[model samples]
Target: MRKNSIKNTRINGEVQKELSTIIRNEIKDPRIHPMTSVMAVEVAPDLKTCRAYISVLGEKEAKEATIKGLNSAEGYIRRQLARNLNLRNTPEIRFILDESIEYGVNMSKLIDDVTKKDSNSHRQDEEQDEN
Candidate 1:
């Protein structure tokens, strides 16, 4: 099967959904923050390995701790995935920190600030013209 085949995509989506549920409801590790979320999942064509991208809305330390907690619970998570998905090979899971959401929010804030400044300048120019 090709790496980007529909089968792989379906597997990836299923894994992501199951992982989100497992992490949110099953895992009770204290190190994981309440705001942690599974952002995306990518599974290899062979289904031997899977990468889960996680996003945590918290400080850097919290994010690091969450990743550590998830890594420590990797075995349990894989087992749960196997039980839930009934796959022949429960892919070895790897947790990766995803910062794209945070980056996007920051970029939006910056754009808003620039837009506000430009509008204020335009208003001031209009006022001067009226004088």
Candidate 2:
């Protein structure tokens, strides 16, 4: 029952930033579209594995291709991390599509539509109340 300290937050943020930059600059895979971005990284408590959530703005085929490309280059990515990060053991990286952003966008659109409908209904009620 302990809170995450500022130092821990900073460390996690640093790791995410490093991973994003490394993937963007170092990993040169044709299958990974330019629209793809590393959104976040969650490292396990023991630091043995890290789940990298990525957001790709493209068709389903493009997303699958990008994920496959990243999975295949996992070994090379781990080696690069070893050279850059001073860790006793580099964690294995797993790529996952971060759908939260997409979900948020969809939710926002739905909310807007609902709001408009409510406003129209309210106006009709007001007109009826006036009559």
Candidate 3:
């Protein structure tokens, strides 16, 4: 199947959803942070392997620990995924840390700060004009 074919897209969505649910509800590892989120999942066309992008809202140690925890629990997660989805091949799950969400948030804050400074300067300029 083509990488972006309709069927491939559907499989990616389904796998992403099921993986999210399994990680959030089934896994009980303490190393996996409570604020962990599965940001995205990409299943290869062959259905033999998958990449799960994860985001953890915590420090570096917590994020590392969460990945470690998930790696160790891969077998159980795969079993749960196979049971949940009736696919020809249950893809091997590989966890990857995604920082896009956090990056976007940081960029937004920077933009807001710049805009606030610009507006304040504009107000000062207006006052100086009036004076």
**C-alpha lDDT score of every prediction, in listed order:** 0.96, 0.81, 0.94
The whole-model C-alpha lDDT of candidate 1 against the native structure comes to 0.96
Write model 1 residue lDDT over 50-88, tens digit each, in one string.
999999999999999999999999999999999999787
Model 2, 14-98: lDDT tens digits are 6777777777888899998788788877776566888889898888899899999889988988888888777766888899998
- Which candidate wins on lDDT? 1
Clashing pairs in 2: none
Candidate 3 stretches with Cα past 4 Å from truth are none
Error of 2 at 20 (Å): 0.7
lDDT of 3 by residue, 1-131 (tens): 98899999999999889988988998999999999988888899999999999999989999999999999999999999999999999999999999999999999999999999999999999999999
Ranking by TM-score: 1, 3, 2
Itemize residue pairs with steric clashes in candidate 3.
none
In TM-score terms, candidate 3 sits at 0.96
Instruction: Determine which window of 10 residues in candidate 3 has minimal summed lDDT.
Output: 15-24
- TM-score winner among the candidates? 1
Quick one: how many clashes does candidate 3 have? 0
Every candidate's CA RMSD: 0.7, 2.7, 0.9
